[model samples]
Target chain A: MKKISTPYHHGNLRQALLEIAVKLIRERGADALTIREVARRAGVTHTAPYRHFKDKASLLAAVAREGFEMMVKETKDQFSRTTQDALARLKVCGIAYIEFAIHNPARYRVMFGTGRPHGKNSALRKASEASFGLLLECIKECQKEGTVRPGEPMEMALAAWSIVHGFSMLFIDNQIREKGLFAADRESMMDVVVDHLYAGFKPN
Target chain B: MKKISTPYHHGNLRQALLEIAVKLIRERGADALTIREVARRAGVTHTAPYRHFKDKASLLAAVAREGFEMMVKETKDQFSRTTQDALARLKVCGIAYIEFAIHNPARYRVMFGTGRPHGKNSALRKASEASFGLLLECIKECQKEGTVRPGEPMEMALAAWSIVHGFSMLFIDNQIREKGLFAADRESMMDVVVDHLYAGFKPN
Candidate 1:
């Protein structure tokens, strides 16, 4: 491949490739993503992407990692804006999760969809764990405040994560719409689902 | 295209095509599913599948419908064999849900993963609703037995459904393994998650 003149240096090339890849996924779906296409869209030489990402899978992993980081930031931003009540802040984080998935369905799918497993030490896996760790912190805070029942915080975090994650997947995948349950009112449906979860975590 | 005669009749031909399509998806990913490939694998002429499916999307919808029916039957079978305690039965169904997804990851992804939306009256949509309706019935049963708190059965069902569905997706997608959360003992992790959900639904 002939080298093309471009302004992007080695440092910015990876970010350029990821941004272009995300655009392709958002507009045409993940199947449309190809290293060549990303390079073309980025206005960089075909070999440029190769320098940063060893393969398409590596590029996808990087995108997924970016997605996880964005989710953690989004959730934290939501959490910070809410009341200090542990339960209330947790609810806010849960809602933020759903909203983020709703707004970024393609990215969300890439983040959680079928892909090569990133090993424990991989940046992608670490980013994902960091996002999950936020939820664990919320669960622990709720326990400390006596709002949530005492139990394994990891288990409680898993429960809360499952509810939100499941609901988001269903909503994004059009299952909720197909069922005609809360089809016309998604916000209220989310509230009801979260309320049930809140009740579930309350001290008996 | 020449019409190729086979052992299957009209009704059986549809089933054969679906089976072949499912096999292709299982071996390859969903993107590997194409009308021509399914027809070739089914030992029929390339045009034969068009007679039953119209297009690739239609064929995928049929497969998804079959998946939903199978899930409903699987859950019902487990529900019937469990003890009379509503909570116990609900747990059985939840476990059944996870097991089914773990065993049939490809079909489960086809059923719940991103795809063209099935309209309200579509068979695929109806089958999915029927599956979810079974969960609602379990929540109602728990309410009758005074195991679960009395509330909107729909909301409670959504809560229960979210946790199980989310956990199954995470497990099947290899997110749990990738994060090293429950690498050695997935079964135990599943139990803990379900137990928390069970406690969540109890009357406070």
Candidate 2:
């Protein structure tokens, strides 16, 4: 194999490295990924990756941070695209979360995996908090609109998160398919599942 | 350091290997677990592990199978301890599931991780089916008792599974604590979460 080392500019170099790292993690599981291997794949000197990533953990943190941002963006885009009520918009956000997991299982795994960034104030941690904050905000909106039951918004948000996140994991892990619960239509299946959660959230 | 190679009977050797494998997985995570490592830790010859486990995948499959069986037993034991109604027993079963994940995060991860056994007919797969089947039966009983709303038993079961499973994953992954959502009192917290799910399952 011929090594193609293209000289990348500083800004582009980091982007290229991250892109390569994401690709490596996707092709091989995160445990198999390494800074040196990513550099090798990028056709750059082994030390080049060190300029951006101190170690594998940092690289994974960066990947997770990117995942959270992208997820937030995608979720927001989906819900905003619809002119539905707050509860309906929240359902759209749930669907978006699942779709993100389906489309980017590798990134999703890293984002939620045990190896995700730690500490309460790390960039990755903050990004994750923001991701949950998105849901909390939606729950509050639903409550304000009187579409959802009155309760602690955090607890309500968590109930919704549990349903969507759990379904995503089951779907991605092939458990749903293995059980033959996932017939051809994923959207409709999720629609019903989300409605079941909404039933609990409905105002009396 | 000195090595201790305590000879073991055939049946005991397999059990020892599994126990060591589980310990190794808990300490270093499943990716770092190897049959050779288990052998070394067990003070047995490397080749000896092959007698029980054909490879790493098979070793993990055995671990996952054991995890499923243990989970089913624990959930049943907890729910049966109380002479509660069907829905109450089902709630108890959900609590048991989360407790199992909390106590055996490593084993739980292995049971649900990507590296779990493949193929539709494997023993591991059957064990997982039976695990879900337990939940399905609980939902069925709840329906028969007129506690749960009428619907496809499988869908209702999936709805219940999603909440507990999702909550388990979040707690095990430390996301709950990271978000400050888990303020100690795991059982109470789980109780409230499971109630939200029950809100959806209740008949109108």
Candidate 3:
């Protein structure tokens, strides 16, 4: 392996710091991650991170933006490869969302961590909107398929988001005890959750 | 009220410390909480809390236990008041759970913040199980009503847990932007989530 020499001009200093910071966050929980530590691990001066991120919060926002975009892509890809039925594709999206969170728990936390975004940082917000848009599109397809009720897709969209987001959060937070939950049990639960979501919608 | 100043020989120093610690946690965030601070607030020696709580983790577990017990009562009470069928009552339980978290954000965080139980104390674990048992009872009712699918109720239990828990977590973390979500909107979202939950369970 070629040695990437240690130099101040590492071409992609912002990316470097963010990458190391994420690794640190994973190894040590998000609350323990620090700017000084990220700089130290990235072989840059503590102050060097300032050039890329004004503060840890903004750096975290950037990490969230990246995570959101990745999730958006993964969700869309999962939907595209699934069966033609909108209901099935939507289930795939839920599964994919959970899978993404499981795959990148650190990024998941960064994306939805303690603070809310302040302003029109449309790049980050757009990624979030795009991921949500995928779910909305799938719900629309459900309406078209006559499987989901046509009125107020927003209700369905919010419902889907809450359940998927809820499932992932439980898993990430380790609230789901595997001792009580079987390997095969998860699929059945998902079935009940996704399948049961149609109960209240009055179809058009 | 006689200001008998909780003397050095006061009855139940342990309970006193826990009470004051919870108060501090409610007022400020967890990071600002310390055993010494708690002891000081309790008007006791810094070593006093150690006699009752082995460490900070033990104290946190104690706090979480209090929160969990509150949830169990709230859930049971929510079901108790409603004259609706089993499923409708279960929805009330879900709302109560979210309400508990929303109203007591700090306590809710301590209950679900860590991946694992910080203390080896069985009391906290029991309290947690007891609260979950409420949900289990609700799921069993759903099963009886033939509203939930035939399978282990644990998954559905977890899914229900996740939707409300995830929503509460986001709302507590303030990730749900004020721009799009109002208090009324949250109620509507909850309605959709609980309704679809029944949909997910019923026969196709």
lDDT of 1 by residue, B15-128 (tens): 888898889888887766778888887777899988887777778888888988998898888877875788787888788888888888888888876534576437887798
Best candidate, lDDT? 2
Alpha carbon lDDT of residue A50, candidate 1? 84
Q: Tell me the lDDT of model 3 at B163.
A: 75
- Across A1-204, the per-residue lDDT of candidate 1 in tens digits comes to 745555446547777788888889988877667888888877777778888888777788888889889999988888778857998888887898888888998888888775335654378878988988888888899899999889888777877888899999888877776665764387888888877777768886
lDDT against the true structure, per candidate, is 0.80, 0.83, 0.75
lDDT for model 1, on a 0 to 1 scale? Answer: 0.80
Q: Over the stretch A1-204, how does candidate 3's per-residue lDDT look in tens digits?
A: 654564458667888888888898889888688999999988878899999887877888888898998998887777668757887887787788888987898888777654444355667777887887888888898888887777666657777777778877666765565325646555665655554444444353
Model 2 chain B: ten consecutive residues of lowest lDDT = B2-11
Instruction: Say which prediction, candidate 1 or candidate 2, comes out ahead on DockQ.
Output: 1
The two-chain DockQ for each candidate, comma-separated, is 0.56, 0.53, 0.40
Tens-digit lDDT track for model 2 on B77-131? 8877879889888887788899999999888887877522257538988888888
The prediction achieving the highest TM-score against the true structure is 2
- With candidate 2 superimposed using the best TM-score fit, by how many Å does residue B97's alpha carbon deviate from the native? 0.6
Candidate 2: which docking quality band? medium
RMSD of 2: 5.1
Compare candidates 1 and 2 on TM-score and give the better one: 2
Which stretches in model 1 have alpha-carbon errors above 4 Å? A1-6, A9-13, A32-52, A82-85, A119-121, B1-13, B32-48, B83-85
TM-score, chain A only, candidate 2, equals 0.89
